[model samples]
Target: MSLHVTNTLSGEREPFEPHDPDSVLLYYCGLTVYDPAHLGHARAWVHVDVMHRWLEHLGYDVRHVENFTDVNEKIVAEIGEKGDSEASIAREMIGATLQDMRSLNLKRAEVYPRVSEHVPEIIDLIERLIDRGYAYESEGSVYFDVTAFEEYGKLSNQRLDEIESQGDPDERSEKRHPADFALWKAGEAHPEEGESGGQTWESPWSEGRPGWHVECSAMSMTHLDESIDVHVGGQDLVFPHHENEIAQSEAATGEEFAKYWLHVRLLETGGEKMSSSLGNYFYVEDVVDAVGTDVVRMFLLSTAYNSRQAYGEDALEEATERWERLERAYERATAAIDGPDAATKVEDAELRETIEDAREAFVEGMNDDFNTREALAALLSIATAINRHLDAREAFDYRGLRRAVETLEELGGDVLGFSFGRADDADGRVELAGDLVDLLLEVREREREAGNYDRADALRDDLEALGVTVEDDAEGTSYRL
Candidate 1:
C-alpha cells in the first residue's frame, strides 16, 4: 500500500515516497531537557511512534532518529538554579525523559543524538553556511541571513515580511533583516558581562552556545543524512524551529532537505493550545496511571495526525469505552473459536465481504495520511458486525473472526500501541485461576454471611494456593493478582 502524509511544505496530502525503498530515514524533533515532558510532548511523540509503526507494518525499514537538546539556554538557567554542573543536570533530566518515554511503550530511537555531544558538527555546519554567504557573524555571534535563503518560510508557510514585523533582536542587532535568527550567541567567561550569565563555550568569536534550531539541523543531518524521508514535529514548531532547520540544513548540504515534512496538530484545552509554559499541561504517566496504558494509547491515536484534538475527561472516557468494546469483541471471537473441523461456515457471504471491506478501508484510511480517526471508525464498524453476529448467536465463519483479530493486532497493538490482551493473559494460568478464585470468593462471602467460618477459611486457603490475595471487610471480599 502507498503511504500518504500531509506534507507541511505544500499544506496538502500527497503519496509519501521515500528516497530509499529498502530503508526509510525519519527524524523527529525531540525534547529539550529544561523540564519534564507534558501531554503536548507525548501527543507529538505518539504521533511519530504510530507513524513509524505503520510504515514498518507496510514493509518499510525505518531508521528513526530523535535528538535531545541537552545544551540549550534553558538547560543552563535550570542548572544554575540548582547549583549543579550543567552536564550533571542535563544528564539527569535526559535520563528521566527516557524513562517517561519507556512508560509510553515508545522504543528508544535507532539514534538519539545529543546536541552537547555534537557541538563540533553544529560548528561545521555553521562554518559551511558562513562560507556559502547564507550566514554571517555579527557582534561575535553567527546569524542565518533569512534573505539569503529565498524559500526561508516555505515549511511554516509564513511570509518573511510578516515574521519580520514581530521584530525580536538577537546579537545581530545590525542585521539588515529583523527576521534573521541566531545560529550562535556570543557570551563572556564570567557571569557579570551582561551577556549569557557565564554559560559560555569557546567558539570562533566568543564563548556561548548554539541556538535551539541549530541543534536539530546538525544532529539530524549527521544521523539521518542530509536529505531525510520525513521530518515530524508538533504544529507549533512549524515556525522558526523547523523553518530555520530547513534554511541551515539545505544551505549547508546544497540538497533538498526532507522530502516530506509532517506536523502533528497540537492538543488543546478549553479551546486554547496546551503548553507546558502555560502551566496547563498533563503528563503521560498521570493518564496511564489513572486509566491503563491502552486507553491512553487509544486516546492519542483516535484523532487524525494533522487535525487538532481537544483532550479532556470526556475524550478519555470515550477512549476507554471504545477500547472495552473492541476488547470484548475480540474476547467473544476467541470464545467462539472451535477446531478447524467444527468451524461454522458463514452463510451470508455479503456479511463476510463487509468484514473484508472494513479491513481494506482501515488500511486505506491509514495509508492516506495516517488518518487514524477514519481507520478507527472502520474498526468500530467491524465491531458492530461482530456484535450483530454475537446477538444472533448464528454459526458464523471463523475466518472473519480470524481476520478481525489480525486487523486489531496490527492496527491496535502495533500501530496504535494499544495492549489489547487482558492482564490475565500475561501469565498462562491466571485466566482460569483468576476466574475460579473469584467464584470461590463469592462462595466464601455467602458462607461468611451464614456464619460458616470453617468452609470460608478452607476456600480462602484454596485461593491462597493459587496466588490470589483476598481482603475481607464488613462490605464483602475482594481479590488481587
Candidate 2:
C-alpha cells in the first residue's frame, strides 16, 4: 500500500507523494531552547522520528530538519532569572534537549538550524513579503498583512472573521489588522521588566529579532525545498505557528510551503493536560531513567500520533511489562539456533506463513497514516505467536525462528527506534561481556560434570555479584544483567 497521511491543510487523508519521488524533505518545528524538554516535546519528536525512519525504510532519501529557536522571549526571561547570557543559556538547553532525544534513541535531524544563525534568511524573507505588499512596517516593526493573504486561515480551518487576534495586545496596536502577526519586532532595551534582553539583527525594518513564526518559515525554506514533503509539529502549533508559517512561506515563494502537515497530539497526565506551569509535566530524561528508554518510547508510540495520550504510572508499568515480553520472545527466537549452520536450516511452512502475515499487517498499519499503535499491535501479535510456538516445542525450525527474530529487530529497532539490547552495548562492551560469561558458564558446566559442585556454586556467586542473574531451567542456563 502507498503511504497515506492526514494533511491538516486539506483536512483529508491524502496519499503522500513528494515533489521529488526519490527523496523526501521533512521539516519539524523544533523546541524553543529556554528550558529542559518535557515529555510533550519528546512525544512530538519521537513521532517525527518514527515517520523519518519509516520513510527511510521505504527507500526514500529523507533530508529531515528540525529548528531551534534560541532567540526568544522565554530565553530572555530565563537570562534575567539566571544571570547567564542568552547564547550561553540557549547552548546549554539545546545540548540538554539533544541529550534527551538521544536517550530516547531518536535520530537527530540532518539539519538543526538555529533561529539566531538564520537571521539573515529570515530578514530577507520578511523583506520579500514587505516588497510584495503582504506585510507592512509600522514604528520600525513589520507585521504580515493578514488581509492580503486570502487563504490566511486555510491551514487552521478558521475563517478570517471567526478567528480572533493571537498577537500580543500591545504589539497589535502597531499592526494593520489585529490578526496580523509580527515578522520582526523593533529592538528594545527591555521589552519587559524581567527580560534581560532579546537578540537583534540589522534589518530593513529595524534592528530586531525574527518573530517566533517567521523563524521556522525562514529556517525550513533555507534548508529544505520551498515545497517540502512534510511539515510536522505538535497539535498546539496547528494554529498561529503553523498557520503563520504557511502564510509567510507561500506569500514569499508563491508556491506550496509543505506537501503534508503532520501534527502529533498533546500528552496528558492524570486526566489533565501536562503543563510546566501546572507542575505536572514530566521531563524526558527523568522518565527514561525511571522506566527505561524502550518502555518510554513504546508507551508514547502505543497511542495514535494524532490523539491525545493520557500517561500515568500504570501506563508506564504496562509498557515495561510489554517490553519485557517482546525481549523474551526475541531472545527465545534467536537462541533456538543450535549450531553454526542454523541459517541454512528450513522452517515449518506454518511458522513462516504466520510471520509473513504479521509482517504484512505491520506494514499495512504503518502505511495507513503511520498508525504506530496498530503497527505495535501487529508486532505484539508476532511476539505472542513466537512465544506460544517456543513454549509448545523446545526445538523448532531454526531458520523460521531466526526470520522472526530479524523481523522484530527490523520493525522495532530499525523502524520504531527502540533498543532491544543493553544500553552499554553501543561501545561493544555488551558483546565482550556476553562472550566472557558464556565461557565461564561452560567452565561451570564442566565443574559440575566433574563433581566439583563447590566451584560451580562459587562461579554462580561471582556472576551474581557482577549483577548477572544466572538461572538454570529446561533450556539450560540463561543470564540477564
Candidate 3:
C-alpha cells in the first residue's frame, strides 16, 4: 500500500505523494530557546524525526529544517533573570537546547535557521507580503491584513466569521480587522531601552524583530523551496501560527506553501497536555538522566506518531522491559548460531511465510502513517518466532538465521534506532565467556576466603548447569564448557 498520512490541511487521511520522489522537503517548528525544552517539545520533534527516518528508510532523500526562535520576548525575560544581555543569554540557551536535542536522539535537521540570524530574509518576505497587498504597515508595525486573504482559516478549518467574533481587539493600531496578526512590531523607544525594548534591526516599518509567525515563513521559504512537500508541528500550532503561515506564504509567492500539513498530537500525563505555559512540563534532560537515552527514545516511538500518548514512570518502565526482551532475543539468536550445524534454518514454506508475513505487516504499519505501535507488535512477533526457532534445537540454517538477523536489525536498528549485538569480535564470544569465568573464579575465591562456601558453591553449580566444567587446582579454580 502507498504511504498515507492524515493531513490537517483537508482534515482527511490521504496518500503521500511527494512533489519529487527522489527528494522531499520537510519543515518543522523548532523550540523557542527561552526556556529548557520539555516533554511537549520532545514529543513533537521525536515524531518529526521518526518521519525523517521512515522516509529515508523507504529510499527518499529528505531535507528537513527546524528553526529556533532565539530572539523573542521570553528570551528577554530570561535575560533579565540572568542579568545579562539578550545576545549573551540567547547564545547560552541555544547551546543548551542543542545538547537537549542530542539527548533525545533527534536527527540534526539539514538547517537550524534561527530567527535572530534570518532578520534580513524576514524583512524581505514582509516586503513581498506588503507589495502583494496581503499586509500593510500601520503605526510603525506590519500586520498581515487577515481580511485581504479570502481563505484565512482554511488550513485550520475555521470560518473567518466564526473566529472574528472572538479575535483580539485592535485597540493599538489601524488594523482593518481584529484577526490581523503582527508581522513586525516597532521596538519600544524608552523605559530601560536595552532590556525592555528587545533586539532591533532596520526595517521598512521600524527597527524591531520579526514576529513569531513571520520568522517561520521567512526561514522555511528561504532554505526550502517556496512550496515545501511537508509542513509539520504539534497540533496546537494549527490555529493562528500555521493559519497565518499559510496566508502569508501562499500570498507572498502566489503558490501553495506546503502539500502535506502533518501535526503530531500532544504528549499528555494522565490525559492532560504537557505545556510550559500551564507549568506541566518535564524536561528531556531530566528524563534521559533518569533512565538513559535509549529507553526514553524507544518509549517515545512506541505509540502511533499522530496519536496522543501519556508518558510517566509506568510507561517508561514498560518500555525498558520491552527493549530488554528484544535484547535477549538477539542474544539468543547469536548464541544459537554457534557453528556450521547450529543455525536457524527455516526451509519449510509455511515457516518462511510466517516470517515474510511479519515483515509485510511491519512495513504496512509504518507505511500507514507511521503506526509504530502496530510495527512494534510485528517486531515482537518476529522476536517470538526467533525464540521458538531457537527452542527447536535443530541444525540451524545459516540462510534462515541470516534473514532473521538482518530483518531484526532493519526493524530495530534502522526503524527504532537501537543497537543490540551479542558478539564483538572473531574470538569475541569465547573471550567474553572466558572473562566471565575468570571473574566468577575470583569471586568464588573471595567467597572462600571470607568463609562463605555455600554461596561460592552455588555459583559453581550454576556454571556447571550451564555446561561449564569446573576444576580446582593450585593456581585456582578453572571452568570450561
Candidate 4:
C-alpha cells in the first residue's frame, strides 16, 4: 500500500508524493536557541525522526533540514541580561539542544542551518520581495505586505484582516496593515527591550537581524529545494511563523513553498499546554533522566502525531513497563536462537503465520499516515508472539527465531529508535557484573543438582546482596537485575 499523510495545508489525508520520485525533501522548524529544549520539542523532533527513518526504509533518499533561530529577539535579550555575547548564548543553548537530541536518540538532520549563517540569503530574499512589491520598507525596517499576497492566509485558514500581527506593538503604526509582519527589523536593538548590537549584519533595509519567519524561509530554501516535499513543525506555528514563511517564500520565488505541511499537535502537561510561563514545562533532559530515553520516545510515539498528548506520570510508567516487556522478549528470542537444539526450519505453521501477520500490520500502520501508535501496537504483538514461542518446549526452527529477532531489531531499534542494549549499561560496569552473576548462577545450578542444597542457598543469598534475583522452575533458572 502507498503512504498517506494528513497535510495541514489542505486539512485532508493525502497520498504521499514528493516532487521528485527518487528523493524526499523535508524541513522541520527547529528551536529558537534561547533556552534548553523541553518535552514539547521532543514530541515534534522524534516524530519527524521516525518519519525520516520510515521514508528511508521505504527506499526514498531523504534530505532533511532543520534550522536554528539563533539570532532572535529572545536570544538577544538573553545576551543583554546575562552579559554574554550573542554567539555565546546561542552556542550554549544549541549545545543543550544537541545533547537533548542525542539523549532522545534522534537522527541528526542532514542540514542544520542557523539564521546567523544565512543572513546573506535572507537579505537576498527580502530584496526580491521588495522589488516584487510583496514587501515595503518603513523608516528602516522591511515589512512583508500582507495585502500584496492574494493567498496570504491560505495555509492558516485565516483572512488577512482577521489575523493579528506578532512581535513589537510599536511596529504596528509602520505596517501597511496590522496583520503585516517584519521581513527585517530596523535596528540592532530589540524594539521593546532596547538590547542592541549583539548580532547584526549589513542589509538594504538596516544593519539588523532577520525576522523570525524570514529566517526559516531563507535557511530551508537555501539548504533544500525551492519547493520542498514536506514542511513540519508544531501546530502552534501555523499562524505567524509558517504562514509568513509561505507568503514570503512563494512571493519571492513565485512557486509553492512546500508541497505538504505536517504539524504535530501540542504536548500538554496536566491538561494544560506545556509552557515556560505557566511553569509546567518539563525539559527533555529531566524526562530522559527520570524514565529513560527509550521510554520518553515511546511515550511520545504512543499517541497519534497530530493529536494532543497530555503528559503524566502514569503514562510514563506505562511506557516504561511496555519497553521493559519488549526488551525481555528480545532477550528471550536471542537465547532461544542460541539454544542447543535450535534448527533452521519453520516446522510450526502457526508461529510462522504469526510473525508474518505482525510484520504486515506494522507496515500497514506506518503506511497509514505514519500512525506510530498503531505501529507500536503491532510491534508489541510481534514481541508477544516471540515470547510465546520462546516459552514453548518444542525445538523451534533456529532460522525462524533469528528472523523474528531481526524483524524486532529493524522495527523496534531502527524505525522506532530503540537502543536494545542492557537496561543497566549506563556505567559500563553492568555487562561485567551481569556476566559474573551468570557464572555464579551456573555454579549454583550445579550445586543444586549435586544435592548441595545448603551451598546453593548460600550462593543465592550472596547473589541477593548484589541485587540479583534468581528464580528456578521447569525451565531451569533465570536471573534478573
The whole-model lDDT of each prediction reads 0.79, 0.86, 0.80, 0.86
Residues 256-304, candidate 2: write the lDDT tens digits. Answer: 9998998888899877777666778989888977887889888999997
Candidate 4 lDDT by residue in tens digits, 1-481 = 8899999899999999999999999999999888888898899999999999999999999999999888876777776665467788898678678878877889889988888888999899999999999999998899998899999889999887688776689998898788888888876755244444567887876777678899898998899978999999999899888999999999999999999999999899887888766778899988888888889988999998998799998888989999988888888888888877687654656667788888899999999999999989988887788777867847876776777788888988899898875555654675788889989988998998999999999999998766676778798789755
RMSD values for the candidates in order, in angstroms, are: 10.5, 11.7, 13.2, 12.8
lDDT of 1 by residue, 1-481 (tens): 6777878898787888898987899999988887778778888888789888888988999999999887765666664564365567677667667767877878568989988888888888899999999998888778888999988889877778888532244343556678788888776333233433424577885677787788899999898799999999888888878888999999988899899999888999888888877878887667766887677777888898788799899999999999889888877766665444215556545546767888788899889888888888888777777777767755666776777677777777777777666555644565777787778778897898899999989988887665566777788678754
Model 1 steric clash pairs:
201-208
Give the per-residue lDDT digits (tens) of candidate 3, residues 333-406: 66666565664534534445556888899899989988888888877787787777767746665566556677
Judged by lDDT relative to the true structure, which candidate is superior, 3 or 4? Answer: 4
The number of clashing residue pairs in each candidate reads: 1, 0, 5, 1
Error of 3 at 207 (Å): 1.2
